[model samples]
Target chain A: MLSEKHLPAFYALGALLLIILPWILTAADSSYLISTATRLVIFAIGAVSLDLLIGYTGLVSFGHAAFFGVGAYVVGILAFHNFEETTFLGFDGTLTGLIVLPLAILISALFALIIGALALRTKGVYFIMITLSFGQMLFFLFVSLEAYGGDDGMMMFEGRNILPAIDLNDRITFYYFCLAIFTAFFLFCHRLVRSKFGRVLAAIRQNEDRMTSIGIRPYSAKLLIFVIAGAGAGLAGALMANHTEFVSPGLTHWTKSGDLMIVVILGGIGTLIGPVMGAFVFLLLEEFLPIIFHELGMDLLKEHWRVVFGPILILIVLFAKTGLYGLIFKKEG
Target chain B: MTQLFFEQLLNGLQLGMFLFLVSAGLTLVFGFMNIINLAHGSLFMIGAYAVAVLTNLTGSFFLGLLLSFPVVAAFALVIELLIIRPLYHRDHLDQVLATFGLILFFNEGVSIVFGRTPLFLNVPEALSGAVQITDTFSYPLYRIAIITVGLMVAAILWFIIVKTRTGMRIRAGTTNPEMIRALGVNIQALNTTIFVVGALFAGLAGGLSGPLTSVEVGMGENLLILSFVCIVIGGIGSIRGALLGALTVGLVDTLGRAFLPDLLGQFLDPATANGIGAALSSMSVYLLMIIVLIFKPTGLFPVARAA
Candidate 1:
């Protein structure tokens, strides 16, 4: 792996490139890359948070997209009501990021608290199923809501949230805004996994019984991180809603949770920057693989890229145990 | 209203039978092999597709159903050798990821081969009409046939597991694979047998349900999660638990969707109640699962050795 002391230089290089990517894309007249980068950054945020839970804490929550959807729905619902000039539960809808962002975080964190309290009681396959069950419940709940477009999903015509000093309606501006958020969360997770609390979580993952014998209850620490991860995912969700201008039950589907997990694992679990890199690689593959297939005259493969993508994923799980990051930054002898 | 209630109950039973067929194999795989096979759903889908294509070709649904068993079993055998055999020693996370990858490949592969348009399998002529259970109540003949077959399978499985020598060996294997291996039994072959049998049942369920539900690319996925709910609620590694859990989930899901709106309308205005009821009913099974886990974390009938 990359040496500990050189990690900051890698981070600086990544940051510098991300900062100039949109401008470079614009110069190339490939402004669509900005939106793509925005999606990558947003998902990177989600992947980083998931890494904290699955990698650092060793809690493989299969239902994490619930928080992501919850955050998007907060933004989506508020934007919908704001457009309709209606009050939802005696509160007028507002599009201010200052209000909506915090609300999204708080609500998603609360969701994690309730779900964590119940699901944390189970371990191994049971925990995975219970979390998936809750995620499905939330997905069906959203799908059943006819007022929000139900199975078809809802679009925000009123546009992105209002933030002070940032015009998020501009694609480049939003890309930078999302990059900033990703950087903040990425750094937060980096610090968190190194802290004393992080060590406890690591210990709990390594051997819960030993941790329990040492008087550190695994439940509370796990719950705490679950909430934190949920909150971070919620922030990413809100950004996702703004980026797409659409929200649907699909956002909360268990498959979305699976995708987030794939991102983490593909990037290299337990490493903050790995998921960030994984996000970049994942979206790039999603974007370019079909075009590449089309260029190669494999029209059938182009439309069914997942046929190729799936085996690649399987091979990664089977052979690339350390992931793309670990492969690139091989540990020195 | 009573008639409607009875009809919905039968519908729930039929749904439960499907859940049982799928979850039985899943629970067995989890119990014996200690693997979480998400691609089990893909097997169900292939079964549906197999039966659909064969039925269309042979002009006989029963023939198609009979043939799908071997087809799905063959596919299962291949999967066992290539993907699952290596995964036995890996952790649950790896199994989940690999199987999840398998789901993608299978779903997309089916879509590529079969096209995205949903396939419709006609109910075989003999079972197409309704059966008069009572003067006032009639149910689809096909549905009743499904329930009967499900029960028969359950009984046969019980007999095999409880009475027959093979069943005893299977049970012994579940409880103590190493001991069975020490006794000169081919444990790997035994595992393969259980895996293929499980796939056969899942295939059977898919072929049976094809007529009632549209045969589609991802048809197995929704049912897959519901079966997972059944397995979780029933307790991992317990066949009896799987049955109870499957029936409970099926009945609750079907009945909740059928009656929740009207039930809630009685207490509140129709419009608001309908909306909330729709959401709540959709969530009812998950709520049931959460409540069950709260009370019995190991599931209703958790197997001792598996735990």
Candidate 2:
């Protein structure tokens, strides 16, 4: 039986795996593997941040990737300005990770604050649709910015941002950077979900009326969590932009947000570590499903793999309500 | 200037009617079942595809249109039975997830079958020409026909909902499902009927609009979001709300796109004006929704039960 006592050990093992992933890949002479692992870590950051809202707070925001896109655009826009040697608004665009990442988080948090304040006014499916509208709004806004390449997206041709005391240009160093940030974020979320605020949010999710009866206003709690989640998503976006060296309006599309939601559900809703596992599994399936089909001599199936993926997702939703993580760590009486 | 404004108004009306056709079904399904059918758009796509394929095969647009309603409804009935029925008892998130999965299935399935190239459906021969509306203005007859058909459907729907026995049962079911179930109404059959009816409406909208737009995979996705905005603004589950919401969205979207850039160009550079205008026009409906939500969280015409 899985017990609360086992959590720390589980986390420790996870940390160990993350720390050694790059080394293992390097030793295996698999640069591609290292890059794929980096992508997983970055997406895990996004999935975990999204879980903070959808899983913990019960806010099924269909626009979480808006913040993710905001983060990436911040990095991309700043880099674009730096490349042109121009000042945007007032500040000279800097390629420093320290400056850009914090800016990304703050900007995304502010966007979340504005969006969440209005979205939180409604409950249930209304909230979902409102968030999706906001996401689509941001997507169109980005696409309209012709200076940033519009639909074509922007590329950081100069490569990764500079961090003091470390070379981000090195693939291995970049991998560690992402891992470290992801670790910090995971720990923060772990503590947040256990904190007083998180409990209040969880209570609100269960029954907002009861919380209100207890003299607890659920609105602020929900808003705070939404902003925090957005900030985390923003940080992930910044890392993603750095990793891919590209940012596009597609990053904020409603479909990307749906993908994030799928990751949260596929792992385990409201479980802090579940999103990380979910991201890993989701990306692995995306990577391997086509290869597996090809190996089976079904090349046509490989091209239309989503036909298979969709049914699997439906089955998971129907049969594994608690998700893959819950199945693995079954609760005991 | 007046002629141009009127022309845009007519375009808005045509678009609004199309939106109503889609939103009406969505509102009905959501009202009673309390399920968010993301794959509702898939039904719309199916309708358009059905019309396109059938029309091309038969070389008769009218016959294709006649055949698509039943074909799409049958498809929806199967989907409701095999997929959507189990989800009726699930939470909103699960419904959203499952329906979202269905969307992927339908989109990819269509792509695999149709090979991704958009299918074209021509305007019917009789409805192809433009009619003079004013000394300076001529509008396409097909668009006017759409508006007339939309109003007719709306009237029929209003009559069915307000003046029929089944409508009473549906309204009762929405307000109190358990009470209606205890009253010996087969809630399952009612729900399935409503789902199929919603699918029929979506497919009809798709078939009718196919000639106006390209019939292609994923074409319904964007329209689905817009229809959602209409439902949210008009108040979910309220037919009156859906009609009002659809018109408001259609007008705002059409007029905003037609004139906003020109308005902005008077003050700003053309490039900046164009950029900002496009962004604002695209966001206008959502902006209206946000404003409406802030003032009326339940929407402009929320059903009594929803409140």
lDDT of each: 0.91, 0.91
Q: In candidate 2 chain A, where is summed lDDT lowest over 10 consecutive residues?
A: A324-333
RMSD of 2: 1.4
Q: A148 in model 1: Cα distance from truth in Å?
A: 1.6
The per-model DockQ list reads 0.81, 0.79
lDDT of 2 by residue, B76-134 (tens): 99989988899988988898888889988999899999988898778999899999977
* Candidate 1 lDDT by residue in tens digits, A235-277: 9999999999999999998889999988989999888888988
Report model 1's TM-score to 2 decimal places. Answer: 0.98
Clashing pairs in 1: A1-A330, A1-A331
Off by over 4 Å in 1: A1-5, A331-333
Worst window of 10 by summed lDDT in candidate 1 chain B = B298-307
**Model 2, residue A1: displacement in angstroms?**
6.6
True contacts kept of each: 0.73, 0.65
Q: State TM-scores per candidate.
A: 0.98, 0.98
